[model samples]
Target: MNTTNSIQQALFHRFDREQWAELRQSVPLTLSETELVDLQGMNEQLSLAEVTDIYLPLSRLLNLIIDAKQQRSFVLNQFLDHKVDHSPYIISISGSVAVGKSTTARILQTLLQRWPQHPKVDLVTTDGFLYPLADLKRKGLMKRKGFPESYDKKMLSQFIADVKAGHDEVLAPLYSHVTYDRRHDEHQPIRQPDILILEGLNVLQTDADTLVESRKPFVSDFVDFSIYVDAEESLLKEWYMQRFLQFRQGAFANPKSYFNHYSKLTDAEANAIAANIWDTINGPNLKLNILPTRERADLILTKGANHLMDKVLLKK
Candidate 1:
């Protein structure tokens, strides 16, 4: 079979944009333009039409799933003649850098929380789980910042386990993009949220080496649902470069920002630097680590060159 035919026969049920939009049914658009603008990333162009067509239906589906799971738990508790503690339903979103994972996470968090059954949704990024700058430097992993080895996998896994065990309060480490490191004195307290959305570059990664060596569960193991945002490598490169340039004029311009030195670079120099970073770090990580995890996700959101989602592939 040809490549396209093989993909069509894969485990996912593919839906084009129009077909996916039709699934929205009667779901209302709860987000205003202002709210969507605030939720967008540096170079993203998220629109109300996109949310109405794509995210609303997704939210409705998630609501039904959550309700069904809760009902199942209740029935099981009755069968066991005991009250089991309720745990948060974890949803993980994974993708390459600049693939708009954060945008999708934030939008979903907002939409999912609006549902009456589960009004409390929390969002956390895996950046906070990355090792401190000093630790990375000591371990000689500075250049491999976003790689799986750079993260404190044990701590991250334990955190998920705690949250999944229905802990009354769990603290997640805080990360600062401005400083490009984890904050030692700060943490976000998660208090029994109905749903938790975990966003990261490698949340779905299941490295065989790590699993064989550690013999422990991966972070994705606790995730009840997972999504992967995807795009072609060329488009991802272009988006990364665009975001880098925008940051040079915006966030990098801050004197305290870790990347402040890049603010003074001319357009050509910035582009060169961005391209080198992508080619050396992000690109390799994507090809070796992130992309491999795409098929592991319960759903895949594929984007076009214009940074708009064109299709969805949901696991059958």
Candidate 2:
């Protein structure tokens, strides 16, 4: 084995849009126009053409990987002459706040569920695992809501563990964006899905001290596959501000909204506030906690300013 060749092979396989589109294998569009409209986030750009060209192929690839994993598990069980339960295949999606991970997860879930073998796909956002708003305020971490310190890492780990163990049912707390807090009475139940799509800003983050020895597993440990959506920091900032302004017009306008005050703000005030929040909170969180995990993803989808997949890097 040549050293240089081995080193090069360890790196990723890069594909431009046209090259990646060639990988699509007749995976039909299952989602309708109405559903696509609902799936897209405010101010985020997504089109059916992009979905057919980019995501269809990605879904096909995931289906192949999932089938292979199942076959391997079957063979191993036969070799051992024992029954070992197969855990749900977990696919994680991570990126900066406005990098379109939510839309990606939703589209993937729909495409994946259309596959014959993996029908019970579910999408779960790690936002539910964030510490309640009161808890954050109590700990003086209000400004750091999206930071790692703001989440209950232990609880999130356990939730993944339970789901991986094939628990009959697992419940996750619900977080309300309108109220900007965890809902006291609502919960989302995971009923042993065939595949679980976990989407969030920090799904790929690991402990700071990776060299330390410990039995504790991070959330990514349960992921069978992961995707990191990527774009330039400046583009992300623009999208975040755009989304914030849209929210101010709609959700924030509700009298009961936690950010109701923002609805009353002038255009200049709203823009300033969005910029300040991004500068002080979301921007730093992306740099320090999120972007560092991009290389760890099984696949990296690099987006252009128009929110199209400009290129993809698949781990070799």
Candidate 3:
């Protein structure tokens, strides 16, 4: 017997786009086209159809899960004869860079909030927890910016723990894409929300380097549900290249942008540079770290070359 194949078959129930879209039956499309456009990431093609077909059903499933968890908590509290503060349900979104994780997170947050059950949904990206540029440079980890070691994992984990502990307010650091660094002066306050969506490249990663006797907790440990956005390596590279070229004219053009030096490059030059960065940095990180965490996710959203989800794999 093939153990690996058997385990996979038992673990996930696969659905094609059409099949998955059918699950959206009776789930109202709460987002307008204008709101969807705002939620779209650079070089991403997010449409109302995509939201209706992919995200609506996902939101519905999440709503159901949240409701079930809340009910279970209520039952447990009643049995214990004590009133306990309801903890926010945490949903984690993890994927390779340029795989549209942020867009997915934003869309889910919007759709989930529209549900009267959990109207207070908050979105937080792990980018903010990344070590500051100066810290990365000092630690000689500049090139490995998105790698697991590049983050202040302790602080990130503590923040999630505090939120899960039902803290009244938890402040999360903010990151500036233009400056390519953590904003020291600015922080996002996560008031005790009904649901919290944490999005990042390595949110699903587990540290294997920790000592066996002194194992540390991972961010995924606190996540109630986790999603992994996926695409072929070639497609991801293409999307990254497109986004990089677009940024040259957009964010990179700003004098305050960390990548402002690349703004003046011609299309060919920009593409060449983008390819080099992908080859050296993002590509390796995806292959070495992010992709390995795919199986750890509760659901995997696989995308086609057209930048739309083509398949859904949900853990059974």
lDDT string for model 1 (1-316, tens) is: 9864376458799999999999999988899999999999989988899999889988988999999999998889899997876699999999999999999999999999999999999999999999999999999999999999999999999999999999999999999989999999899999999999999998997646354666688988899999999999999999999999999999999999999999999999999999999999999999988988888889899999778989998888
Question: What is candidate 2's CA lDDT for residue 31?
Answer: 74
Models sorted by TM-score, best on top: 1, 3, 2
Please, what is the TM-score per model?
Answer: 0.97, 0.94, 0.96
Q: Candidate 2: deviation at residue 175, Å?
A: 0.5
Question: Looking at model 2, which ten-residue stretch has the lowest summed lDDT?
Answer: 3-12
lDDT of each: 0.92, 0.89, 0.91
* Candidate 3: pairs in clash: none
Number of the top-ranking candidate, with TM-score as the measure: 1
Q: Between which residue pairs do clashes occur in model 1?
A: none
Worst 10 residues of 3 by lDDT: 206-215
lDDT of 3 by residue, 5-111 (tens): 47657889999999999999899888898998999999987789999999988988999999999889889989999877759999999999999999999999989
Name model 3 segments beyond 4 Å from true.
1-7, 209-213
**lDDT for model 2:** 0.89
